[model samples]
Target: MRPVPDRRLWLLVLGFSVWGSALGFVYVLHSVGCAFAWPANAIRLGLGLVLFVHLALVGLLWRSYAGTYPGAPAVDPTDSFLNWVILWTLIAAFVTIVFTLGPTLLLTTCT
Candidate 1:
């Protein structure tokens, strides 16, 4: 038993593992020629570009925004936890999006 925080970190790791497993399955389906729509490469490229812009906006805002308070408690556990959750969720989503689109773009453009 590590600790509550460590356990939460493990849970987050598990969630990412599940996500990777699911993406792997999708790749298998794609390999066997079972994919629907055949995924237009142009669409993948366009969407990837759009996603990049969105990610850039998020990064800029994340750096520019400041929520610190002078009289706030030393450490608000709930706020910290929520921030971690939100940040990791966004990171996972971006990773998945890139993984999915990268292959599609390559397949489309290469073929």
Candidate 2:
């Protein structure tokens, strides 16, 4: 098993995952009749800012990942962070498409 992460790192990851999931859930609601249009870019910016702050706070915690743990392989922390940023960007794009194009598609079938 991997070593237990420090409390702060655990908390940081939990916070980000929850924040992202909550944002995603709200996007889903907007999809299904929540009335408000999804501001995908703005929400993406907010997520980026939150991630930056969290990373700065937990910067030290990432040092441990430089080397392999007992069972885990070595990982590049920078790449991992970048990967998450890219993943979030893609999700934002998908949400944007849903909000922008989905309605048009819905409108077409009825007319």
Candidate 3:
């Protein structure tokens, strides 16, 4: 089995991966909603729902972030650093989604 320290290394990519996926998904969703000539409220509602779900998923990722499992031998300081990096990366991703796509929820795009 891979060393525990390196097991979580793959998580480094998770934060921005989610953010980028959300960015593309939000853009496409909004575009489609506008193209369909959907009602203003309906479009915004859809946007709101998507944003909510994305945020929730990111929150879940935050809850799941861990650089080292408990009960295992303590790793070097890099493990704690990894923990902080994961925490902040997720935070940044969450904030980026909120500040960028969240505004569309409060405003109409199909009107």
Clashes of each: 0, 0, 0
Report the C-alpha lDDT of model 3 over 1-111, residue by residue, as the tens digit. 224466688778788888888888788888997888878787777777777888888898888764343333665566666767888889899999999888877775865
Compose the digit string of candidate 2's lDDT tens values, residues 1-111: 344346534433443444355446445543543234435554444445544444443343333433322333464564455435434544444454345433432241211
Of the two candidates 2 and 3, the one with more favorable TM-score, higher being better, is 3
Instruction: Give the whole-model CA lDDT for all candidates, comma-separated.
Output: 0.49, 0.42, 0.77
TM-scores, all models, native as reference: 0.42, 0.31, 0.79
Model 2 residue 75 lDDT score? 45
lDDT by residue for model 1 (1-111), tens: 222455445544543444454455445545543344444654454545654665554454344322432234664665455446645654665566567645654554223
Which model, 1 or 3, shows the larger TM-score? 3
State residue 75's C-alpha deviation in candidate 3, in Å.
Answer: 4.0
